[model samples]
Target: MQVKDKVVIVTGAGSGIGRATALHFAHFGAKVVVSDIDLEKAQKVADEIVTNFGESLPIKANVAQYEEVENLIQHTVTAFGRLDVMVNNAGIGPKQLLKTAEHTLEDWEAVIAVNQTGVFYGMKLALQQMLKQGSGNIVNVASLAGLKASINNLSYSASKFAVVGMTKSAALEYAKTGIRINAVCPGYTESALLDKLLSARPDMDTMLKSIIPMKRYGDAKEIADAIVWLASDQTKFMTGQTLILDGGTSL
Candidate 1:
């Protein structure tokens, strides 16, 4: 689990799970690239890493755009020479939940652009660099909604399911090439995304907790730990698998 000196890139590294993952990877002595659509936030995270005696580089890139993601990879390689692990963690959901029929095409497209197509670009571009290096790891951040249907989150659910599928498919295609791809499906985690959802419907918090056997929302660091583990040599033999850290919510 050392990952010392490995070049790692974490998209959406500005806050929440993404931020935690960046810090965690840096903690393990990895040269981390903190990428996000928000340059200010990304830089702040990078500064924090530096303050903690870690190496980090903050770059701005919206994962939804192909060129930006391409530039992100390029900038990373320019700075670190090679990419060892890529965390496709940037994603967004509708501000308000809506039934499938009530979801507008605009809403669906927006979520899909960031959550699904964004992952495709990340994986494709990252694969190109990894292939040259002959060894690399990829970790996708999906959700419990991916494995199970959500009540009123058609776009989000669909996008995450696509992520899970893509992770498995890509993992198989690159299985023999020293490139391992996997996904982490987290449930009810204490992220800014969850805070927004709960803010909208305060009562939903209690309802959500009641359904989880753990009776508590997971900490961001908890999920970050799992992502780091999956990306480390300890799980070198693992690939094409979805590691669920939802406290039995999927069960």
Candidate 2:
């Protein structure tokens, strides 16, 4: 176990990429805090972790709220004694695809609230705890869209691009302070998020695959594996880096 007994917090752990990351952390012997907007889903993942491998706690917090995000970090430290790893994995896309001109104010705001502001909250709180502890690892989830423009994904692209900027800026500021920060930009992963996207825009399924030279989507577990590896000491020399796991699509 690369991170034996390390206390790790994963936001948006109710389902999709978040759930998979939480479970992977637990499997490698980390104490995981499964945090989600839905307490029930968080509890289920935490319960599964307790049943199978390491210890876990379920926490309900809307990442869009600063107080809730603060509480999530505070609670994890109170229960586990320290914060070693933090995965800012909570994010949202717009409810419906709209062009730049047709986008509603509400839709844009909602996506920014969670995807951008939420990530900021998690990183700030985790840093407060880690700066005191003198070391930590932070992994923010970005998207291939962050690397370039995507069709029908205006708000999401903007938010994810902001995340990328945040990750790099923080990593530079703390490069020598014993904390490492990085981001993972995934492309067309297999998760509830992708399912919903495909469901809403059936044409997207075909359109999304056309750009991938590999002609395949990534798995949630695959993304989780990258997050886990980045959190480990094995990658101590790496920071301010955006590792794009997009099945060679960026190529």
Q: Which candidate is the best by lDDT?
A: 1
How many backbone clashes are present in model 1?
A: 0
lDDT per residue for candidate 1 within 79-147, as digits (tens), equals 889999999999999866999889988889999999999999999999999999999999999999999
Best by TM-score: 1
What TM-score does each of the candidates earn? Answer: 0.99, 0.98
RMSD of 2: 0.9
lDDT of each: 0.95, 0.93
The per-candidate count of clashes, in order, stands at 0, 0
Q: Please, what are the lDDT tens digits per residue for candidate 2 over residues 144-194?
A: 989999767788999999999999999999988899999999999988779
